[model samples]
Target: MDQGTSKGVSRTDSVDNGEGTVSKALQGSRKKKRDKVSAYERAKKVYEEIQEEKRKERRLRKQEREQRQIATEKYEKTKRKANKMFRKRSKKGQPNLGAQVEILLEKIQQKMK
Candidate 1:
């Protein structure tokens, strides 16, 4: 058989010629050559990664700040409600201490639960 142009032989098909396989040169030629990365490209990639990390951290911090703001707003709303309740006057024109203490106790119990 003619080794150079065998019938139905493909480049991927290895041929044994009693010495060894003859596809090493073909395989080497088929492999893609890798180009070395330049220092500027490496630095640019590192800088981009650092910037991405900073953006992620900033987003996390913004979310946390928003959460804290929401908690503060809720606390302020409850505080205003409590102050309004304490400022209620009776027929005697005095602060409703008894009702305020009852409301405070209920809030404490709810927090404990």
Candidate 2:
């Protein structure tokens, strides 16, 4: 019974002539090699993940900027409304005591000078 190349292994490695010597070559070569398509797929997957993270960060920053603009607008609107109310009250015979005190104090200081 003559043994030829057995499943890609050389014939010399498979046949033993009563001796116990075995070759260690080609022992790790039986595993399938990594193809180019699989490596490309992995790199593409990693790139897409990084792009998604960047998009999420941009979305969060955009939301924060919009919230800050809305808060500033609300503050400006409240200030305008308060000033309008104060002017209306003063026109309706309601004098601000703090303004009268400041005017009297300035008059007294000018007289002393």
Candidate 3:
């Protein structure tokens, strides 16, 4: 075996062709490039997964908002109908059985709360 040194670099084993030479330093740069591409691919996959999870959460929130709106509309329609029925009987100046029942039921519900 032969050893040589040149300008702060050391070579352990090397072969020289008629035109050029091969060295470990040149191969190390190619390995570094391969590592960079792999790291980029892994990061891209993680970002996509995060976006998908956010989309699912948004969909769930939208459904909850729609359900709440539907429930509010139903309660308001029922209350409005009950009020209209009571007003009609009061305008006619007669106490009707149906209006009395509705008033009693509303009072009972308020007391329970």
Candidate 4:
């Protein structure tokens, strides 16, 4: 085979050319020269972000629990007041059961509001 020309092969298509070897060597050096400190900083930043998200979630759950407790207390207070009023009215000899029920319902609705 002649150095200038080959039967079906071109000079650019040959991997044995020197350019390919030089480029591969440069790429290897570039990878080895990367900063280790930057990688550590990136990992630390990711960890902090995850911790912040967890804190937000915990705060939201606590607020929901507090709201539930408040609602329960309010409901219990309303129930006790209604029961006391019903007993007082009964002891007074109010004979109409339907009127007493209506009064109890109205009191409950007013307390809820």
Model number with the top lDDT: 1
Per-residue lDDT over 15-94 for candidate 2, one digit per residue giving the tens place of the 0 to 100 score: 34356535545333322343335777989999999999999999999999999999999989866755554455365688
- Please list the C-alpha lDDT of all candidates, in the order they appear: 0.83, 0.68, 0.76, 0.74
Angstrom error at residue 74, model 4:
0.9
lDDT of 3 by residue, 1-113 (tens): 33556654455554344456656566567568877757778899999999999999999999999999999999999788777776664557876678768778987998999
Clashing pairs in 4: none
Q: So what's the TM-score on candidate 2?
A: 0.45
Error of 1 at 29 (Å): 12
Compared with the true structure, what per-residue lDDT tens digits does model 1 show for residues 48-112?
Answer: 99999999999999999999999999999988888888888899998888879977897999899
lDDT (Cα, tens digit) per residue for candidate 4, span 1-113: 67787876565544344455345456566668774458779899999999999999999999999999999999999688766655653566876576568777897888999
lDDT for residue 36 in candidate 2, whole number 0-100: 33
List the lowest-lDDT window of 10 residues for candidate 4: 13-22
Clashes of each: 0, 0, 0, 0
Give model 3's clash tally: 0
> In candidate 4, how many Å is residue 57 off?
0.6
Query: Lowest summed-lDDT stretch of 10 residues in model 2?
Result: 27-36
Ranking by lDDT: 1, 3, 4, 2
TM-score of each: 0.66, 0.45, 0.52, 0.50
Which prediction has more favorable TM-score, 1 or 2?
A: 1
